[model samples]
Target: MIGRITNQQQLVSAQRNVQTSRALLSQLQEQAATGRAVTKPSDDPSATASIMRVHAQQRATEQYGTNISDGTAWLATVDDALSSSEDILRKVRDLTLRGANEGTMTPATRSAIAGELEGLKSDLLEKANTTYLGRTVFAGSSSAGTAFAATPAPYTFTGAAGATVQRRINDSETVRVDVDGAAAFGTGTGSVFALIDNIVTDLTAGTDLSARIGQLDTHVSALTTQHGVVGTRYSRLQQAAQSNLTQSTALEAQRAGLEDVDPAKAIIDLKSQEVTYQTALGVTARALQPTLLSYLQ
Candidate 1:
């Protein structure tokens, strides 16, 4: 089908070529101006989907970071309180040793020891009820203002039994941030508060304080062991936080690579497209040049 080539057909084909080149030039200019390779999903659908996935991961990582921070704070408060409680009990043990010694049992000395024991009990109560951000750290999710109630006799634990407060540090890990007040500081007649008061009773009645000294040691040991557990959990949260930070940064870089434009490459492309478009225009103009014999046709 070697048919005659018509002037009208050639003109239409040249115009279509120029329009396509102009459109490509316009697109390159937009990419240069916006500095984004994929302005919309239609520009690069696969890359856009990848960018969306990366963004979702980044958001989850950021929330994990926040949880790690809050969990660390909760553990820190518990650790400090436990340490203070241990120190108070140690001091109580020393005073009991003095009272038990047969050489130093003066009336004045016993009275002073009793008074100081009362003050130490108050301090231990304060530690057991210690709060972090207005919530007791030892309360295990109980909304009570304090972990232990002092107004009622025997000082019952206000926190609920078998309850826990936890934080999700990552996809696979959840950590308990709150300590059990009952486990750490007993309850009712078996409580450390009651223990301190009982020691004062035995001291006032002129009984040997040797047994009270051993009881104080037991409470001290419990506090020390619980503090060690808290330290371990705190360290875990810190590591999780670091890992989250690294993950977030990597995801952000991936997102940028998928969406952001390379300035040098964009400039080179823009110039190349412009040259092609200009050449297309020149050729089309020359090819469609007005002929002197047009009126005869």
Candidate 2:
């Protein structure tokens, strides 16, 4: 009776060892295959926390990329409007030069140039009222309709004051996305529109206007300077966009490393697990088998 009981105890111990070994081997296989120690909170609390943090960083990076794209588009719209305004100003400058040569142009010729000047002014006003995604690009921070605010009244700046529509490019850095219409075109000390208007008025009255050519030349120079500023800003935005794209790509790669499984590694681990489980089953079966002496007893 003692011998039979000892044998039963030995068999139970062997079975327990096999079960424990199989469980550990299965866990190892899963870790090797998934390249992750935790599939859920129950698997590993610490690893789960690390994964959550990495995921949050990825999400924030994606949002930052979105902001960069939106900011870039806004800057693009502003740059385009400024470029158009430059072209219009160039034409106005040419007309002014022609008007200055009063010896060659008759009064009727001057009047025709004035009409064209008015048309150019209208085109410039349209550019000043340019919008991007429903927001006025030249209105500064004020959302008031009509950037130029022309009421058949000449030489007036009815738009909002100061620079507005700033965009954040980094944690502590922001850039203004708009050039105020008043600063760019309306009547003021540095106003391009007022210069053109003066030239047109002088030409319409059949005035020699030769003295105003120097002032018009200065206006053209200022417009050219502003255009260079806008061009430089556009280049900066392009650089930022490129940097963002690179950062987003790096973040995606890191996220993939954190979450994605390698198929080749998974297949090898699965095969090893199958072998370990089969070995455990064979050993358990042998240990659980009844002996002849047990039956006799």
Report the CA-based lDDT of candidate 2 relative to the real structure: 0.72
- Give a tens-digit lDDT track for model 1, residues 150-195: 7765688889777899999999889999888887888888888898
Angstrom error of the Cα, residue 88, model 2: value is: 1.3
TM for every model, in the order presented, reads 0.90, 0.80
TM-score attained by model 2: 0.80
> Which residue pairs collide, candidate 2?
none
Error of 1 at 59 (Å): 0.9
lDDT of 2 by residue, 1-297 (tens): 454456667677877877877776776677766676465687767757777887886676666667767777887887788888878878887887888887888988998999998899889878878888887877776666667666665545655687467666555566666776665664643466666677788898878777777776775565566667667766776776677678778876776676556767766766777787788788778767788886675
On lDDT, the candidate that comes out on top is: 1
- Model 1 misplaced regions, further than 4 Å: 3-12, 289-297
Which ten-residue region of model 1 has the weakest summed lDDT? Answer: 288-297
| lDDT score for residue 255 of model 1 | 83
